[model samples]
Target: MAVTFYINLAYLLGAIAFVWGLRLLSTPDTARRGNILASIGMGLAIIAAMLAPLENTSNNYGWILGGMAVGAGIGWVSARRIQMTAMPQMVSMFNGLGGACAVVLALVEVFQFYGGERTLDSGQLVIVLSTLLIGGVAFTGSLLAFGKLQGLVRDNTLTLPKHNIINQIMLLVLIVMGVMLVIQGQEAGLTMAMIFTVLALIYGFSFVIPIGGADMPVVISLLNSFTGLSAAAAGLIYENNFMLVGGILVGASGTILTVLMCEAMNRSLLNVLIGGFGGGGGSAKGADGDQVAKEVSINDAAIQLYYSNSVMFVPGYGLAVAQAQKVCKEVDDLLEANGVDVKYAIHPVAGRMPGHMNVLLAEADVPYPKLLDLDDANSALPNTDMVVIVGANDVVNPAAYDDPGSPIYGMPVLNVWEAKNVIVLKRSMSTGYAGIQNPLFFHAKNRMLFGDAKDSLNKLVQELKNL
Candidate 1:
């Protein structure tokens, strides 16, 4: 019992470390250190868990050890081998696994209670129901998000008529079933638990499927919150302080991120929850063979911008994929040295999340003054000599202006189309994650440079040096 007290105290200390790590993670400069601190805390928590006594006659220790070993090995390999491009999918899977673990814990505890007591008391029933509902929702929703991020499923919106009404009705039924389970407390409890799990799984899928790729980051963050909440519910059931604290950290951070993302898009969290922006509508896709825009060599683009007075650079997810921020900054520096003013146009929802583009650029030590938000950049576009669209698509699409039936027609965009000259870097004329072709590529003023982002940027950098 004394040992148990010591182990619990140590676990509490470890949990505090997790909170410290989260605080450090708020800034890019400290993010690496924060992750290291968090890992150390987790290691300490594992030791405490392993040392906790479960009685000599109990075989639970062996199962715990085996499960820990297997999970650790898999986590190690996955973290070491995953590519940066596939990080989103990896995050979803990891979060999903955490949720699944909570679900298993809840179910195991329920089975144990039923095996002996044969019927759950009201308090136990509530705990079991909460864990099942939260865990089940996180599990299935995370899987669907993972599928979308991995391109295993269509990234377009999945919606049907009267979807909101149906979702509401289902929620009401699930709540009623949960209450009945608590009151009935025997055969009905187990059956209701199963039904609640099923409803949760369906609701999870329904909640995420309508969200488009553009909102995948927010969806992932929200699911992460759900995972944490599920873990917290399980912790309450099992009386685990470490689980409660860790889950609270995850839930808090995830919620903050969700709010930040919502603000970046100038949308309320409720609006996003109601499924308006991310969903696909009946917007018409552009006609095929619409590649009227001409592809230019690195030399041509360099020449066009070399003598320009001012240039605005627009970056998107491709910049992060290429990890070309440093290269981009170098080009900007060279342009500035030659009396060519260079500025960055950052879209609000650019890259995979809010401020993702800004973070990547800042990592390369780009000047803070040079970074311009959508509105600021839009105001400067008409006066700019050259607007460089670096691995961007949807943000500058001209169809948004003339095509009233377009999915993104009403959404605000950068005024790059109004710039004097537009140069775009891309691999092909393929549409963006929104699953729609950008009419900006077909604009007569826009010139495309086809190749890998880094390679193209590097070539253009070299070409500019020669000029």
Candidate 2:
């Protein structure tokens, strides 16, 4: 009785820690601390489980400890070594692993029940099947997403003729199989369950393959939610309170993030899922036919920045691709030193993932307060003396506002053109991920500084120092 009491007490404490940690994760400043607290909570839960009064749990401690050590070592190494650019893919992979774990747990439980004299109740069977189905989908879906983001798989939508019809048929079959398994009960359901799992895995791959690259942020979040719900189902099967609570929190958070991402792009969840939003690399002609963008030299750009009282920086995936966050920060520092009030204008869907630019800038030690969201940045742009666009294209395009027929018509974008003088540093006049030409380049206030982002920033820094 005493051991049981202590174990329950430990679980309660761990639950509190998880709640507190999740609350803290709401803000960027406390995100690291929140992650640590969550890790500690998980550790406490693991310890309590190992120390439970269940039969042979103590004897299995060696196996548990060995597994923990191996997992910790790999996680530590991966966390330290993975670059920020690949962070989204890493997140997808980890989420997939979580789902895979849930699937494995469900399978183990099924095997144990079948091999032994024990029989699973209808409720237990439902939970097991739920976990298996959801986990299977999340595992394969996330892997496909990771492959797309990593460039290992084609980022465009992959569809066969009448793919929608095929998908509908598969979904209906899966539902029918699940219903049949539930009706058949313990004696005759194992085969159905196995078939259900295979079908779920195929559905996952098919579900995500049709989504285009631009919709990945939303897809990733949705898959994360699926994984969390799967974990919750597994927890219900085992009656583990800690897993239940953790899964609920993750599910709720991921759902909210998915909604926010969809809103950022001014897209509906269904539209993203139906695919074909972001694909093709060909550029659209300018509204007034093809026009050459005016160019500016590094010295001239530096002179504009040096003279401006206030400057705003608009960064995009190009900055991340060039690994120029550090150099961008250096430029901010140099501008600040010369008495220019500097700030960053960040779009909600600026980069490939949510908070991608913010994470990169944070790693370069950029102050959190300097980062302004879309609305705030737009408000600041008109009053700013100069806007330095670093490897950004689609986010600053005036077409979002001016062109009613454009694909991204309703999407919010940085109002860099509102500033008095805009210097855009990019390698070329290529369209961004959306594959649309940016009319902002031809705007009277804008001057193109064509080059690699890092090199251009370095040159600007040298010019500033010389001045």
Candidate 3:
């Protein structure tokens, strides 16, 4: 008991460390050290959790230790091997694994209860229900998110014929099943458990499939929250304080991130939940804008940037894909040296995840003071002389301004068209994740400089240096 008290104290200190580390990570320069500190805190928490006694008589410490070793080995290999582009999918898979673990743990407890070896109580039953429901959703939802992000499956929003009605019915049935399981009174409860598990699996996939690809970052954060909540539920069932605290931290952080991301997109969480954007390959049919080829030369682009007094740099997934953040910074430097005031305009959903663009720019050693969020940047775009859009598409589209018929019409944009000159670096005129052409391409003020982002930026850097 004294040992358990000491472990609890250690766990509290570990939680403090985790929170402090995350605060440090919020700043770019300290992010790496923050990550390392958080990792150390997690290690300490794990040790304390392992030392706590299991409530059940069926103790298999050796099996638990073996499983932990195997999991750790796989995690090490995967993290070391995966590419940066695949990071989002890796995150999804990791979330799914956490959910799977919670589900299995809850199931084991339920099994022990039903086998007449352990008594079930109301508190434990609530924990089991919560874990099963949330973890079940997280597991299947995250798997689908992984497939979409990895391009293993089509990024199609697969909505039910009568989605609202169907969803309501499905949810109602699941709730009913959970209530029944809780009240089954110990008479052959295995069937009830199986039924609940199956319902949860179906609900999980169904929940994620209808969401479009453009809103993946929010969905990922939402699923992350679900996984954390599941872990907390499982912790309560097992009476583990560290698990509860850790899970609560994850849930709170993920929820905050999801809200921030939604705001960045000028969207509400309800809109994200009901609208379901970011499926990947396709979405529900919407207005397809006319495409026109309007191209320009690197020299023309350079002249515009060099002469402009104020320039807004808008970034997107393409910027990250090319790993051109450093070269981008170089361009910004050159533009600034020429007396052009430069500020980075970042969209909330820019890149693969929340804070993704910020992460990339931080990697390039861009100052946080120079980065502007959507609202702040949108206001400045009108007075700007040039808007240098690097591989961004739908986010800056003018169609969002006047075309009520367009899918993203009501969605707020960067107001780049308001600038005196818009210089866009692109490989091709392909539509963005929305699968619709951007009308901004045909705007008279916008000039498309066709090429790879890295090559184009490198050339621009060389041209600037020569000048």
Candidate 4:
């Protein structure tokens, strides 16, 4: 009785922390502190779970503690050493591991229940089967996402014929197998569980392999929700309140993020799941008629910036690829020092993932107040004197605005073209992740400053200082 009280208190505190931490995470100012608070909450919940007394559950402290320690050490090292460019890959991998944990927990529950006195009730069957399936899909699916982001898997979308039909059939078969397993109960339980797990794993792989690289972030977020749902199911099996609450919180938040991102891209969740955007070889054409892009020298670009009253910097995946965020911030600081009004316009889905650019910029000590979201940025763009696009393509593409027939037609984009002057820093006239050619290059007032983003920014900075 006394032991149970301590467990309850820990779980209650942990749940409160998680909620408060998530609330704090809504803004940039306290996001780090929120993250730390949430981490502490999770730790408390874990320790409480370890101490709780549960029926038909193994308390292998040595094994559990050893696994926890190893995972912690590895995660700590990875966090310390991993670069910002690899953030998406790391996030995908971590989400995948969460799924794998749910899978293992489900397996342990089923395996130990063999020859037990009570048969699995309908509730247990639902919880256990759902956990296994969801967890299995999340594990391998996330790994595939990580592999694509890491360049181990091919970047392009690979689909077999009738892909949708094939998945439908597989899901049907899994359902039938699950129903049969539930009916057979303890008699054929062990064998069927293994078979079901294997099928789930295969489905998970097939599920993600056809998705294009550009859709990977959404896929990762969706898979994170899957992992959370699986964890919640695992909690039901273990009868742990902390586990249930934590899992529910994660699942709900991930689902919300995924939905918002899909809306931001002006695509349905179904369209996102069907994949085949981003990494495909295609570009959208629009109203901007000038095919010959105008080029501006570094000195000329610097002159434009120097004379401008206000400037907005737009960063994207190219900036990330060039590792130019720090240099980009340097340019911002230089302009601000020169009595120029400067702010950064960030798209909701800027770099490969949500908040990717924000993290990079924050690492350079960019002020939080200077960052603006889509609506606010768009409203400010028209009054802005100049817009310096740093390796951004799709998000600022006029194609999204003027071309109704374009793939990204309804997607929200930074209206940088509305600014008095537009200077694009790019290596070439290459298309972006959506595989869409930007019409912004040909806009009458636009000048393409073609070069490596970091090097170009360095030259522009030098030219400004000279002036």
Worst 10 residues of 1 by lDDT: 278-287
lDDT of 1 by residue, 1-467 (tens): 89898898889889988989988886666777889999899888878876775565665877878988998999999989986556678888898888888888888876666566545579977987788878887898889888887778774346666666777787788889888877876757455566677787798777776677777777788889989988888878867788888887788878888887676555566666664443433333453563476888888899988899999999988887887778888888888889999999988777665457777787788877788878899999999999988777767766666787666665567879789999988888777655567777767778888988889889988999998
The clash numbers for all candidates, in the given order, read 0, 0, 10, 0
Give lDDT tens digits, candidate 2, residues 188-225: 65666678888988888888887877777788889999
Off by over 4 Å in 1: 1-5, 54-59, 117-120, 155-161, 187-189, 273-296, 304-312, 320-348, 353-387, 396-421, 428-430, 436-446
User: Which of the two, 1 or 3, has more lDDT?
Assistant: 3
Which residue window of length 10 is worst by lDDT in model 3?
Answer: 278-287
- Candidate 3 regions off by >4 Å? 54-65, 276-293, 336-339
Candidate 3, after superposition: displacement of residue 432 in Å?
1.1
| Model 2 lDDT-worst window of ten | 279-288
lDDT of 4 by residue, 186-259 (tens): 77668887999999999998888777777776887899899889989898988888889888988998899899
Per-residue lDDT of 322 in model 3: 79
- State TM-scores per candidate: 0.82, 0.95, 0.91, 0.95
State how far residue 81 of model 2 sits from its true place (Å): 1.0
lDDT of 3 by residue, 140-197 (tens): 9999989878876665446767675676688899888888777774773787887888
